[model samples]
Target: MKPLKTIIVMLLLLSISTYNCNAQDVKADVEKMHQLYIEMINNSNLENIDKLYTANASIRNSDATMINGLENIKNQYKATFDSGTFTISLETTDVSQLDDNHMFVSGTFVYSKTDEPKGVLKGEFVNTLKNVNGDWKILKSYRYLETTDNASIINSVYELFSKGDIPAVLALMDDEIVWNEAESNSLADGNPYIGPDAVLNGVFARIGERYKSFTLKDVKLHEMSNNQVLATLHYVLEMKNGKTYTIQAAHHWTLKDGKIVGFQQYADTKKLADSEKI
Candidate 1:
């Protein structure tokens, strides 16, 4: 009976030793495959992908749609690169080894375009690596695309305004406009300019009169909410008296139906008075 006990114990020990060895091998292989994947990406070699992926591998986009099969991945890549040239990079954050054969890798995908001032897209990604026949391969990969923040959109609106495209600037706002001013006369008159036409006539027309020519420079945009924006303007006003006055001002805006529904302006009254020589 004691001999039998010894044999059973030895078998269990052998099994544990084998498991650890296999786990170590898998870890090493996964690391090697990671480097190989990166090399393939840098080289832009799609042909070698078959060496790292199975015929039935799957990829899930940030939108949660699963694309299956090796050919599908190739097609997706082709379509994306064709639409716009891009260079993509990956950054791994958290990695969990599920077992000797499986792992979950969390990371980020950064994309850069050929265009100047290339916009950045930041998003999360997850990749599942599987060991098949002593080789590490990507079994499933997922990624999500990030959206631009409100500040960026508001800044873009100001850029459009600076170009003197009133229609283009107004197109970004809601139809029912609410315009306010800090001046005593405009405020005392209970003047809250509403709608597009009223805004163009009552408020925007007044702006033209204040300066022979006005240009916004070094403007800043802050998004108060998804539908509201506070645009801070640094403007140079060219006066009729052959002088230029610089003013810092802010405009609060609410948007509805892709148009400016509400607007409020704020500025230093003293500075404005000095500019107008009032």
Candidate 2:
């Protein structure tokens, strides 16, 4: 009963509304896929993982192993979960809805073993998801086991230090790294060292001069949001004065572009002071 122009306008508006709704639906479905994948990995729920993939899905693991089909993927996950107690953390860096039925997602994945809390496996991954029966299911996945992000960079610093590669450790730091030593400790005399050169001169030089040996033990790195890393470690120092000290310490590192820009130290300074005179 409406005029032809009014009918055409109504149809156009309806089409636009439908397109918007479909776009929103696609985004929601893709996000759900990410959430369910993370949940399954963190919980080690292999059964649910199987359901998340298509029957003919293919996955290329970071280790270069190729797995095909839902069964094989489930078996792979089961074996991994059985081999160790671990938790997986995921962060989606980018996502694109290729079409209404397909989505592409890329993200960072980190796996931490419970027994070896300090050791972590980090990687970047891309997944192709397809809408299957109104659900987003992974059609193909590829993972690369290398990360150049802030967390990985900071972790490398500790790894280098553990290996006594001080130069390599220092190389990962910013030229103007703001290094802070724990208050009340002998090293705190420098307070905030402004540059890597200052840190090497004021902090590391002092430690080397005063201690027979200084090492970090039981180091655990936690990747937090916003380019921050938390390191829990113990400083085992043998003073040149024939005394050994073990102090619990924490380092909060802020990083940008794979370089440590800021560092703050927190420790049992009273214990450190007590050990100094002993």
Candidate 3:
């Protein structure tokens, strides 16, 4: 005859096997639901959105901004669709059944506009699926969408300056700014200019006093993943000496909180020195 403890151990193993099997089934079901969601969004069919999402469903943007309720979600979706023809694909990567009433799901999504079918944007998302009325629906979604285009922000500064909007240009700089000039340049004396006022007085004022005119030409901005922007352009300067010269220059900019925090200049110094005198 088998011991009583042996029987209990056998039952426990059987129960665990059963629960694992159920978990696998749940994962499969969630993936299928996501496929249908992709179809609905791609087709712009929100007529039955209520059937898909809970009334209190909310989206948490990458920036921590929340879009609450079904109406807001619908409006955002409608706006995206109106923007252009787009197709989205989501591939389920992980699913965890937190409890009988809640499941956690995560996946990567790639969305491509019709005009450029290969792919336009790719991001990952984590979603909480809740059991409401015996139906699985997204309770909360956390996803990423880049709100700050660093290149565009820097480009706007140049555009504003070209229009003689120096105040607008100064507004883009943070309260405390660190500015540096290229070695061998006269402006390098104010290396590590501490504030916007310092930059305005030490750099802009000096340039305004010494030069007849100064502007950037053929400017192109390159972005780095680490919040740095590199702008390549020609420094079109009309020296008080009455000669106009264009020197290749590059500016390395660092930004935080949508404001410029640091700047480093690289330019042809010899040309600048020769032109300064005659």
Better by lDDT, candidate 3 or 2: 3
Which candidate leads in TM-score? Answer: 3
Q: Write the per-residue lDDT of candidate 3 for residues 120-193, one digit (tens) a residue.
A: 55678999999997788999999874346878879998999889888778878876888999999988998989
The C-alpha RMSD of each candidate to the native structure, in angstroms, is 10.5, 13.6, 11.0
Better of 1 and 3 by TM-score: 3
Residue range 1-278, candidate 1, lDDT tens digits: 57998999999999999988866766566557666666655556676688788778999876567899999988876676565555667676776789867888877777654441224456887889887887768899887776546566567677777787776665555446666777753432547766667766776677787778888877777777656888887778788887888888887866542345677778776676777773
Give the per-residue lDDT digits (tens) of candidate 2, residues 36-60.
8777877877768755899999999
Query: Candidate 1, which segments miss by more than 4 Å at Cα?
Result: 1-28, 145-148, 156-278
Question: Local distance difference test, per candidate?
Answer: 0.70, 0.82, 0.84
lDDT of 1 at 167: 66
Q: Which residue pairs of candidate 3 clash?
A: none
TM-score of each: 0.50, 0.49, 0.57
Residue clash pairs of candidate 2: none
Residue-level error in angstroms, candidate 2, position 74: 1.7
